[model samples]
Target: MTATRPDPEIPAKLLAWYDKHARALPWRAMPGEPAPDPYRVWLSEIMLQQTTVAAVKPYFAAFTQRWPDVAALANASDEDVMAAWAGLGYYSRARNLVKAARFVAELGGFPETEEGLRALPGVGDYTAAAIAAIAFGRRAVVVDANVERVVARLFAIEEPLPGARKAIRAAADRITPDERSGDFAQAMMDLGSRICTPRAPRCDACPLAADCAARGHDPQRLPVKAPKKVKPVRRGRAFWIEREGCVWLVQRAPEGMLGGMRALPDDGWSAAGDGSGEPPLVGAWQEAGVVRHTFTHFVIGLSVRRYDGAPATVSGKGEWWPIDRLDEAGLPTLFAKAARLARAASERLL
Candidate 1:
């Protein structure tokens, strides 16, 4: 697949289209406007990974309101940031966001180049390119999922994803104009999200439809994806120890899955297929229910059990959280589901 397909006029056409149709996103700067705050761009890109804009909008708003800037986010407590980031699946991103914030704050400001930005704690190749092209007016090839689809369709790169990304990225680079590179990258995103949608692309309205090789030939199928492998299902258990209107919660060790987030004391199981661990304490425990959660690589069936001892014999390094205020504890989605089931099964807690 040749990098420069059809012509070099793709960026010009795309940028012209963007000036009138750029999305009014909270984190994005409109076309022809000054670049947006680098902090917002970085934060939004991190949140947007494996997450949709619709889903990220409210979280982005809340986080920006709370943290405001890199310095404010850096000054925030780990627990506070983690709590605020609850329900946004990838817990590790929140943890890394903290590390990167502190690093950037200490360094005075965000690095302007893609290579420099990639040094941030959790920033990856795609994120670094996006931040550079969008925040610093850098002429970087930004190939996000949307851009991948657009470029693949434009060049009719029939190769499947993961492998075809290289060719698609190369094609995108040829079309990425030097001037207003930020706007060009964003324009491709808008074109893909709106005109070249995954299903039923509106080719007639696309500015680049004239040069699209996949046009009038089922363009939706251009960016083929490899088949998904069967995910292994693992089983685990969660314990609910309640006493005197308080449920026990413990902080996960600062590594591995869901690390540093406050959650229910479980059987030391983090999506493992191993035998379950012993309960926190020996007591007459009743089976409450199961909480089913699906991760990217696997599925987990977390069995919830309740300790119904008279004194609720609890001995552990955890806090007694009031049942009514459990919502504020910021338990990750899985633990939150388990807590709700435990609460529903017990009448004495609330």
Candidate 2:
């Protein structure tokens, strides 16, 4: 793909600004930090998906220290890896992370070209391009959210998201430089994150201010977005059976939503309209309360039911633990939130 030359002064402008004001992040090595490590960059990118840099910082530090390298991550057990990613929300990303690590480890290293990177388990068009350019110093275009906003507003494109994503990608490709591709990619990413913010973008400090179509006309309204699709609501029941200050917790199925994460014993949730399924427990059930949680595409309403004088074991699955020690378990955020609500209500009713 032909790369577009940003205004001759744009790169010079952006790099100068970056030199003075780049956010200090751990994953970011300074200009000469042994060139970019494809393994580290790939790992950080995967973990950063749909997660904020602040939220991902601790997890990234922990993982790098514990595993240290792609080969170490590849050899980690599923349980260990999942536990390490406990509160990051999207469990699938963690699973894919390990899969990709193993694949790359076996192959010796990440592909230096976009096509080769795309062949890895979770690497898509954007990710492949990012790795190819940022880590391997290849001339590839990267159009992440930051880059998209920068491109969309720069050209004053009004297409909605997802629909507009492709055009934005094309536009970004045009501006990427053949030389210093790594620095060029980082420069754009940094510019978008810092100056070209979605709200109240600091146009005065922007390097491409002269070429910015949005700034030239109406910066605030350039990159228009279509309305978001409504997320569906889902419902289910969670059995909060407690005895002697201990709560019953279950491990989700090995595959599927919230898979392998620790959770309260629950009636399998359904996407349908009603929630009348059998409680994932035995004994006379009573309505304790209800807890509601929202996922990206769906909202989940979990009705809390309480069972008293229940047997020590539920026969076929999960484990019961001291209620106070729930923190030690690898529970996802949603379930952990629900558990807190359930326990407080349980205390109130008793």
Candidate 3:
């Protein structure tokens, strides 16, 4: 059961295990049931990318409830969509989701082939393959993080990640069953997530125990990963201007980091400062403290400053939202944490 000589029965044993034990998810159709709707499949795949299942479940349910179909999502405004996608991070995916949805709607439906799906705004290689296989029942090889681990161990490939990805994909293609490729892909994902985990794997319950290449050896160590580079830290300042029971909020520019989302106006995180040392409004400023948040590439510390001057002097396009209804402002987690800090400080005054 090596990479060059994988057991052909791998897919069958895994799929049989899946038929009886596949995790019941809101977006999946059972083993023998009809394939789920393409729109649902596409949406779920998009939401699940780089995100955990538990984190995505509530968001998926809310999005589907608000926009039931591709056409419905296509008709949504960017503001509403961006706001809905606030806490999901990877803000670009939400932006791309809108673009792809509208494209599918105008085209009248999702493309049924891997190549066709690739042409969509956000559908990359993995996403296109998954949608084609899972929704259209196309015999496409779908390899995600979970599948990568499973295949790496099944064939006992010791090549480190990124570099080993090519060999892993090749091995996966060899073992992929032409029939029920959709099921086979999902089965691999389930087996990887549930049985062949990254940490302590439950190999005793594994259906492919006898056929596993890394069975006698340390299976968890296969699919070695490259060392993670440390993320650099950046600092910025967020202005918290409270007027009566309301707080001022601004919409970020339509592109770049945290773009098109509501946020407490901030001096951009630059040494030269996009708006350094200057608060949005001229007022006596009191520093409330700092809130730290980490992004994919950098960590940020945003200093929250409370304005203690005249509110009438503030004139801008941004609105003074009632502090009580701040939840509906769709602030990203960074600013949300800042708001909480500001509220806690304000409560001390009373």
Candidate 4:
């Protein structure tokens, strides 16, 4: 199909709006300023995936302070990176970040094109397009969730997502200008986030209010979403073996859920098994309590079982982490929640 030309006024209007109200993000350069460093742009984009700007700020600061550059990040130990990323939830992104950093360091610099960026470990279509436009001054159509909403409302595309993505991209492509594509992209995101919000859009304050097609109708109803599938709940058990103010913690296998992170030994909860797996050692076990955690795919109820046997009986490939320093172990969120429950139950018995 022949692509329709973007409204000539859209780019000018958006760019003018961006010049005055662009967000002050660390990864973004001010309007009319030199583009941000590719490394910072890439790192922030990765952390921002499936996460919010508020949640990514402290983590971004910490990572940049420690790694500083792609080379430094490449040289960082896997355990250290994983530990630093403990509470961030998506463990695989942390793993892929290390891999991508190493790959980039080996190449001497980051790729300057969307295609090249996509070749990296975890960089996908949206990430590649964003980096290309924002860091390299390339004219690529960057359509993230925010851009999707804006484009959908601007064109009044009534198709639901996943299926409607093609039409949305075409519509976004029509609006993307040749010059300052990066600013245009960020502007769309800002407009969607601040003015063209999902629940209650501030159409009166929007620069494109006159051009928006959904303005006459319910804008939120555009970019319609498909029905969501029900998330399944799973059950499992965690062992709390305390000895001399230390707890036994094991490193998870490197190829599964929460892989390569230190965690409390459990009855293989991730594999959809009932909380009936054997304990690490023959001991008098008591039910401490349960910790509920939700994953992207499932909800888990982890039964925290305390070991009442002697500490000498606990033998495995795990380390005895000091109870006082448990936070340093970098356990994943689920395991961290379980540890909190175990600690609380222990305190109650005293």
Which model scores highest in lDDT? 4
The local lDDT score (0 to 100) that residue 329 gets in candidate 3 is: 86
Q: How accurate is candidate 4 locally (lDDT)?
A: 0.90
Please give the distance, in angstroms, between residue 68's alpha carbon in candidate 4 and its true position after superposition.
0.7
In candidate 1, the residue pairs with backbone N, CA or C atoms under 3 Å apart (3 or more residues apart, or in different chains) clash, namely none
- What TM-score does structure 1 among the candidates reach? 0.94
Give every collision pair in model 3.
none
C-alpha lDDT of candidate 3 relative to the true structure? 0.88
Which wins on lDDT, candidate 3 or candidate 4? 4
Q: Write the per-residue lDDT of candidate 3 for residues 33-97, one digit (tens) a residue.
A: 99999999999999999999999999999999999999999999988898899998878888999
Q: Kindly provide the TM-score of model 3 when superposed on the true structure, using C-alpha atoms.
A: 0.94
What local distance difference test score does each model get? 0.88, 0.78, 0.88, 0.90
Q: Which segments of candidate 2 are over 4 A away from where they belong?
A: 1-6, 243-246, 286-288, 322-324
Q: Kindly list the per-residue Cα lDDT of model 4 for residues 1-350, writing each as its tens digit.
A: 98545578999999999999999998899997999989999999999998989989999999999999999999999999999999987788899999999999999999999999999977999999999999999999999999999999998888899899999998899889999999999999999899998898999899999899899799988789988777788888899998888888999998789988999999876645456667878868878888888777778888898864346646668888898988889998888888888888888888
Candidate 4 at residue 62, lDDT?
A: 94
Query: Which of candidates 1 and 2 reaches a greater TM-score?
Result: 1
Task: Name the regions of candidate 4 deviating beyond 4 angstroms.
Answer: 1-5, 271-273, 308-310, 313-316
What count of clashes does model 2 give? 1
